[model samples]
Target: MSILRHWPSVRARVGRELGLVLALAVVAGGVLGFLALADLVVGGETVAFDTQVLMAFRQAGDAAVPLGAPWLPTVMRDITALGGTAVLSLIVLFTVVYLVLVRRPAAAAFVAGAVLSGAGLSQVLKAFFDRARPDLVPNAPIELSASFPSGHSMLAAVTYLTLGVLLARIETDRRVRVFFPFVAVVLTVLVGVSRVYIGVHWPTDVLGGWLIGAAWAMACWGVVLWLQRGRPALAADG
Candidate 1:
């Protein structure tokens, strides 16, 4: 066809890549949807595995807390802070301020949108599941909305991943720059695990959190990639 003849190769390749990314997002979302549905199906509005795991994790945390070294609690607290609202809030504020004060509005907006989108999705998932907290922890100091997919785990993946993406976009070194996402992935996982270690969430909750969060991060980064390709304003050299 005439249209095919005129189409640019680069554009065509990009279109194919975008289609693949979109397919991946759909599959990921479907998996989460299925998991949620299965949860409702298995126990009729109850999460069995998630509850059991959370209880087990909480018990483990309780037993370890007293027997563990003095510094462990402090370390867990620091890691747990990764999922705390304060940390995520500060990250957004700092990034926005840095971008605005330096007059890089486009980059700021793109990154902000990317991060907020992930946060919004996390809340939606939390509300959908509405799982309970661990009773074994005995003293759950801070409050939580849902138990299955931790808010902290989700945020850690979202915010930290967004930070990694932004950093990678600006970096010159290929290998070291790649570490941004790798480290963010590691930190996100550690924070999620710490939630269970500290007895606030279950192991299954963290796993679900990791799956959903990691998938969301991937989805968001996929969007960033598409945006970079689609719009000149949001495009970065990397």
Candidate 2:
């Protein structure tokens, strides 16, 4: 009798929360993809694609000279800087402050926690993998960190995507919600591509970064959905 009584409410809840299911599915795919890529990286199996992509960005006979106009590298450096630690940190700080000012302490806390933990995760993975940077070309802006899983690419995805989802949740308009996440995806893709073009990271390194970062963001999204499951209005402040 109790089971029969609960079935309708359970079905209703499931119907209303389908987005949560999708988010979880994405999280699963990202994790599995990242792990598979990592395996290939560790087994020395990514050389072909990585080499091909990196070499394609440079001139045929001169690896030091990138294929684009001389000014393009300068623009790429500026774009890549958007994903750097300093820039991302500042963005996170400003966002948290804005949320707090709007009396959204819970949202602020979640953003801070998610970004910090994601950054830590990136560091740990880089150290564990201990992969070397690409030497086929001279790195435009030299890097000192271990190379597999580009930090800039990962952090950009984490911070930008999380911020985008938060903005989407706060807005009630369907178009506005879609727009926020779309911009986030564009920024993330550009940052990852810049990492590859600059010669500081292997193609697989950026790929692994993107996969893990996306997984982390989607996991955060699932948490937000769970929090707002019954009360849609709570999306604005919490």
Best by TM-score: 2
Instruction: Point to the candidate with the largest lDDT.
Output: 2
Candidate 1: give its CA RMSD in angstroms. Answer: 5.2
Each model's lDDT: 0.69, 0.88
* TM-score for each model: 0.75, 0.90
Off by over 4 Å in 1: 1-67, 230-238
- Stretches of candidate 2 above 4 Å error? 1-16, 231-234
List the pairs of residues colliding in candidate 1. 54-202
lDDT of 2 by residue, 1-238 (tens): 9989999777646844886898899899999999999999999999998999998988999888887888999888899999999999999999999889988888898899889999999999999999998877764666899997989989999999999988887787989999999999999999999888888899999989999999998898788778767664334564
- Determine which window of 10 residues in candidate 1 has minimal summed lDDT: 229-238
Candidate 1 accuracy as TM-score: 0.75
Clashing residue pairs in candidate 2 are none
